[model samples]
Target: MAAKTKKAIVDVKKQFEKIAEQFQTFQILNEEGEVVNEAAMPDLTDDQLKELMRRMVYTRILDQRSISLNRQGRLGFYAPTAGQEASQIASHFALEKEDFVLPGYRDVPQLIWHGLPLYQAFLFSRGHFHGNQFPEDMNALSPQIIIGAQYVQTAGVALGIKKRGEKSVAITYTGDGGASQGDFYEGINFAGAFKAPAIFIVQNNRFAISTPVEKQSAARTIAQKAVAAGIPGIQVDGMDALAVYAAVREARERAVNGEGPTLIETLTFRYGPHTMAGDDPTRYRAKEEENEWEKKDPLVRFRKFLEAKGIWNEEEENKAIEQAKEDIKEAIKKADEYPKQKVTDLMNNMYETMPYNLQEQYEIYTEKESK
Candidate 1:
C-alpha cells in the first residue's frame, strides 16, 4: 500500500508539470511585435509609451557612444546595457523619487530614467568621483561595481526605512552572476527576518561574462531562490517593457504596503560583452543566439506596440533621436571640461583622522605632483 501511494504521488506531480509546460513566459508583447497578452498590459497612456520608447532608444544610443568613447580612450571601462534597456527603464519608472535605488554597473538606464543627468553619467565614465553625486531628493547610491555588494547596502537602507516607519522602499538591482555571491543570501535573509521593504531586482541575462546560466545554477528559475528566503518571487519577461513595469509596480506596491520584500527575476539577455574591454562573446555564445535575441529586441517590440496604439511615428522618432544625440553630446562636452579628480581626494575620504603612514604617503604624492 505504501509503494502504491508513492507511485501515485509521483504520477500526480508529473501530470501537473505537464500542465505547467503549456504556460507561456510572462510577456505583454510577442516576438512578432504584437501584444500577445492584453490582459497583462499596464495602465500606460500614449504619451507615456512614447516617452518610455524614447528613453529606451536613448539608452541604446548612449551605450553605443560609451563603447566608442572607451575605444577612443576618452573614458575608462564601461558596462554596456545595450539590450537590457527595457528591463532597467521599466523597473525604474515604477519607482518613487523618495525611494532609494541601489544599482549595479549596468544600470545606467535606470539612473537616467530616474532623472540622473546624462552629464553625471559621462562624468562617472570619465572617472570623476563627484559624478557619483546624485541630486538631492534622489535617494540613489553610487553604482556598485563589486559583485553582490549592493544587496546588503540596499537591505540596510530598507531596514532604516522600516525603523523610521517610513513608506519608502529600496530597489536593488543585481545580475544573475551576482546571485552566486554569499552576500546575496545573507541580504535576502536579513530583509526577510525584519520584513524590510526591499525589492531585489535580478536581471538574469542568461550569461555572466562567458558563463552560461545552465552552468550557474541547477534551479529552473532564479525566482525560486526567493522561496528559501520566505519571500514572494515572480518571473517576468524582461524584454517586455510594459510587463516589467507592471511587475515592478506590483512589487513596489506590496513593499510599501508592509507586505515585506519581493524577489523579481527578469528573464533578459545582454547584446554586448560584459564590458567595453571584455572579450568577444562569439567565444562562448553563437551568432545565431544573438540573432534570436535581436529578433525580440525590446526597443523594436515596444515601438511596434506604440505604433499599434497610434502614438509612434517617424517624425517623433527622428526628433527623439536628434534630441538624445544633442543631450548626450552636451554631456560629453561637460564631462570633458570637468576638472580631473586629484588622486589625494581618495585618501581624504578613507579616514576621519589620517593614519601617519597615509599622511606621509599623501604628502609624498602631493610633492611629486607639485614638482
Candidate 2:
C-alpha cells in the first residue's frame, strides 16, 4: 500500500509538469502589431488607447532624459525602464484608485501612472526626502530601492486591508532577480496563509544587471514559485499591453473576491543597463540578444497596434515626442531650483520627542556646518 501511494504521488507530479508546459506565454499582440489573441483584447476606446500610447512615449522620453541627466551630473543614479514600459503601465492602469501599489526601483512608469508628480521623481533622484512623500489620498508607497524589500511590506498592507474588510488590493512589483530573495517567499507565503489581497508582479527581463535569469534561479518560470506558497500564478508576455492588463485585471478581481494572492511573471526585457551609470550590456550580453529584443520593443509594437486602429499617425507621434521633451525639461528645472532639505528634518520626524543623544548630535552637526 505504501509503495502504491508513493508511485501515485510521483505520477501526479509528472502529470502536473506536463500540464504546466502546455501553458505558453500569454500574449494578445503579435510582433507585427496584430492582435493574434483577439479574445484577450480589452474594450478600450480610441481616446483611451491613444492616451496609453502617449504615456508610453512619455515614459521612453523620460528614460532618455534621466540617463542624460545622470551623465551630466544633475541626478545621482537612475534605473532606466527603456524596454519595459508596457508591463509597468498596463499593470498600473488595471488598478482602481483605492488599490495600493508597492513599486521596485525600475517601476518609475508605474509611479508616474499612479499620479506621482514628475518633479518629485526628479527630486528623489537628486536625493531629497520630500520626493518620497506620497499624496495623502494616493494609495501608493514610495519606490523601494532595496531589491525585494517591498514584497514584505506589501504583504503586510494586504493583511491590514483584509483585516479591515476593505476591497483594496496591494500590487507589489519585483524583477526576476528579486524573486530569488528569501523575503519574496516569506511575503508570498504569508499573503497566502492569510488570504491577503496582494498581487506579485515579476518583470522577468531575462537579465538582472550582469547575471542572466538561468544563473538567478533554477525555476523554469518565476510564476512557478507561487505553487509552493499555495497561490495562483500566471505567465504573460510583458510586451503585450493588452495581455498584462488582462492578467492584472483578473488578479485584482480575484484579490477583491478574497481568493487570495496571485503571482504574475511578466516576460519582458530592459533595453538599457541596470542603471544610468552601469557598464554597457554589449560586454556581458550579446549584441544579437539586444537586437532581437529591440525587434519586439513594447513601445514599437503598441504604436503599431494604435496605428492599425486608426488612432495614431506620424504627426501625432512627433508632437507627443516634442511635448514630452518640453515637459521633462520643465520638471528638471523645477526640481533643480527646489529648496534644499534641512538636515534636522530627517531625525526629527520619526520620534515624538528627540532623544537626548540624538538632539545633542544634531546640535553639534549644525554648529560645525555653520562654522
Instruction: Name the regions of candidate 2 deviating beyond 4 angstroms.
Output: 1-16, 350-352, 368-371
- CA lDDT, every prediction? 0.85, 0.88
- Model 1 — which ten-residue stretch has the worst lDDT? 15-24
Q: What TM value does model 1 have?
A: 0.92
> Candidate 1's C-alpha lDDT?
0.85
lDDT of 1 by residue, 1-371 (tens): 46553444457667546544533367778766687788878888887888888888877888888888889888886898978987898898888888899999888667777768888888787767777888886788888988999999988999999999998899999999998888889888899888999999889998888899989987667777887899888888899998899989988898889988998889899998888876788999989999999987998888888888788988988887788788888988888888777767777756788898788889887887676
Any idea what lDDT model 2 has? 0.88
Over 8-54, each residue of candidate 2 has an lDDT whose tens digit, in order, gives 44576676677579456899998889989988888778887888888
- Candidate 1 positional error at 20, Å: 6.6
Clashing pairs in 1: none
- Model 2, C-alpha of 201: deviation from truth (Å): 0.3
